[model samples]
Target: MSEATETEKPASSSNTTLTNAQKARIERNRAKAENLRQAKLVTHPYKIGPNGGPEGNSVIKVQGTKYIDSGGGFLLEQPVLPAPGQKSNAEAETPVVIDDGINIPVKYEECLDCGDQFADSYLFNNFGHSVCDKCRDTEDRHSLITRTEAKAEYLLKDCDFDKREPPLRYISRKNPHNVRWGEMKLYLHLQVLKRAMDVWGSEEELMRQHESREDKREVGKARKYNKQMKQLRMEVRSSVYTKKTTELHVHEFGPETYNEEEDNYTHACVSCPYTETFEKM
Candidate 1:
């Protein structure tokens, strides 16, 4: 009787177990999750060969690094080609014809007055006018006409109208004793009358004085000279008529009348009664 001690029963040897259908379902779910992950992988740029194959099968080699896609296996390469009746990209971009007008060199000439380079058609001679045709036409119309007319009128009005005279005759008068009494007297007394020409301060002043007494003085002197000349001409005509000779006639003798032969008189003085006296003297 071992003091009636309690003894533990031996543990039962039972193992936990699952059905076969449950294990197959778990394997199928794991395969589906792996396929989804492979679809999400991105494709990168790659080179290809002529036979429509990637440079290195399904694996991309970038800087010696290999990237593999487990799902698609490999990607094919397609070469880009031009469409029918279409030019190639390089040929289409090239220009066919160049602009020949731009390449031609232009010719020019120097202007005579301004010494500036201008086209051949632009060259012109001004002659008396100072400005060009375009400038003259565009500017005042009276400019060209006024200057030309002024010069012409001035020349016409200022022309010398006085004539030359003949040489002086040194004739001596006979006295009672058969000796020469009077000194030699020149036949012609043509004088350039130096009448006081009005000296105005300016052109405007002269124009203002043209209607004054100074202008009248000039006119009076001209009239007196003309009257005296007419009287002398009448005297010569009277003498010629009285002589009843066609060759010999009367001439001016020191503001007086003198008889001279026609053969001695080569030409007549315009202002005086002498015949070519001033010119010969």
Candidate 2:
């Protein structure tokens, strides 16, 4: 009985050793397969559009090739599936709405020159015309006057004076009689000059305020001139006289009463005595 037990124990030990060796071999092959998989590369397919068709049917399809490595020993290529028959080239053959200048919709009106929609049009002030902004800017560059210049001209027109003379004063006159007209003209000229000065002064002030400390010296004269002009205008307005004259004049005519030798003579004041004689009577 003891000898049979010893033989069985040795047989069981040999079986255990064989089983462990087989497991180690299997594990090594698995590790080799995992390493090959990590080194393997894959490629994906590219696609374009799946635009809709007239019948409302649409389809998406992938093009190009794909390759996969199952193991180091084998390379497999994926088979391409043809697009479904219902996905025929319907999108490519679909008809687009085109206008033939007749029966065209109002919403689709396009500019003839630019090929852009009419809704994006702009109005040009020069010709009082409508055009696209791009075309308008181009025209403005070649225009005789830009929008800014046009605005300035309009402003000047607003303050322009009539060339015709005023009513009831057909003859040329001077001094006190034409004083009102002269004063009015002078006032208008002064107002215009004042506005011009203010505009210039504002621009200069802006430049001076923005300049560096080193550049402010360049603006000193302009600052001084602006100050002097403002002061002068104020003083003139306060001290100027704008009175109207009211005096009568009489002309005397006596025949052959001139002093021949001197050719000139002075007259004396005259008085009446009828009231005093009547009172005495």
Candidate 3:
């Protein structure tokens, strides 16, 4: 009976210890539930109106952050303040940055006039010429020439500019004279001269070809003028004069002459100066 009582006493102490541990766990769970409820409850600092709504302003401060009612069933946080001495986004200028993710090395060309290496220039961009912008002479050296003018002045055909090996480059622009007209193709004057030399062999040869063409053109013009004048004269004569049909005339022989050496006979017509010679066969 003593051993059983001692065992019962140990069991009672063990039960007491378990009860205290369970009570501690329950208290901790209750504190956690209260914290969750407080976090879920949103409190607005503004005064409540009679209609049980926030007064005047739609702004609300939560967790030290101010948020405005977005009116679309959501709240928007206030814009972050810009750093001191830095311009606001609206007033700041956005810099343009180009990133192609390519590390291609730029090739430079020596300018014809300046003899300086450059990566790009107006003439180079438009015509693939090596002349830099500073040395470009738009009115003289690097002047633009119309395709028609180039062809006419250089005596170059379409094949020379387009079909030849390494075809020439040109720029197109709307016709200044008439916008409705076809766009005009412009080529560099110096390049045109070089192409002309290539086609004609030399500047002297080109000049000679030009002179020969001019002479032929003049002759053709004169011939055309003469033909036109002849047509005009014939028209005038036809309008002023009337034609009269006449019967064919029969020649009347006046006499016959004998050629002893040739052994032939010749006869002369009486009404006209018509003569006839015949051999008696």
Best candidate (score: TM-score): 3
Candidate 3 residue lDDT tens string, 118-189: 998999999999889999999888899999999999999999999997799999999999999999999999
Off by over 4 Å in 2: 1-77, 80-144, 156-281
* Ten-residue stretch with the least lDDT total in model 3: 43-52
Local distance difference test, candidate 3: 0.83
By lDDT, the better pick of 2 and 3 is: 3
In TM-score terms, candidate 1 sits at 0.22
Cα displacement (angstroms), candidate 2, residue 155, comes to 2.2
lDDT of 2 by residue, 1-281 (tens): 99999989988998777577789999999999998975553322222225322111112222654443333445445433446664335565788888766675554335445767555443422222345556544433323332223224323332232331221111123345566654212112223333434444654653554464336666887879867876666566554334444635333423233344533343432332211100000
1 or 2, which is superior by TM-score?
Answer: 1
Q: Comparing candidate 1 with candidate 3, which one achieves the higher lDDT?
A: 3
Question: Candidate 1, clashing residue pairs?
Answer: 165-276, 165-277, 165-278, 165-279, 166-276, 166-277, 166-278, 167-277, 187-253, 187-254
Instruction: Tell me the RMSD of model 2 versus the true structure.
Output: 23.7
Q: Cα lDDT of all candidates, in order?
A: 0.42, 0.42, 0.83
Model 1 regions more than 4 Å off: 1-20, 39-93, 98-105, 114-116, 119-281
Best by lDDT: 3
CA shift at 191, candidate 2, in angstroms?
Answer: 28
1-281 per-residue lDDT for model 1 (tens digits): 44333222222222234458877888899998898876674544355555534443455555655555433565333333467688877888998886666566765555444555654331133222233333333233312222223323222121221222221122233444446554322111111111011123345554555456568888999989967876777676666547755645555344323335421224454546555421111
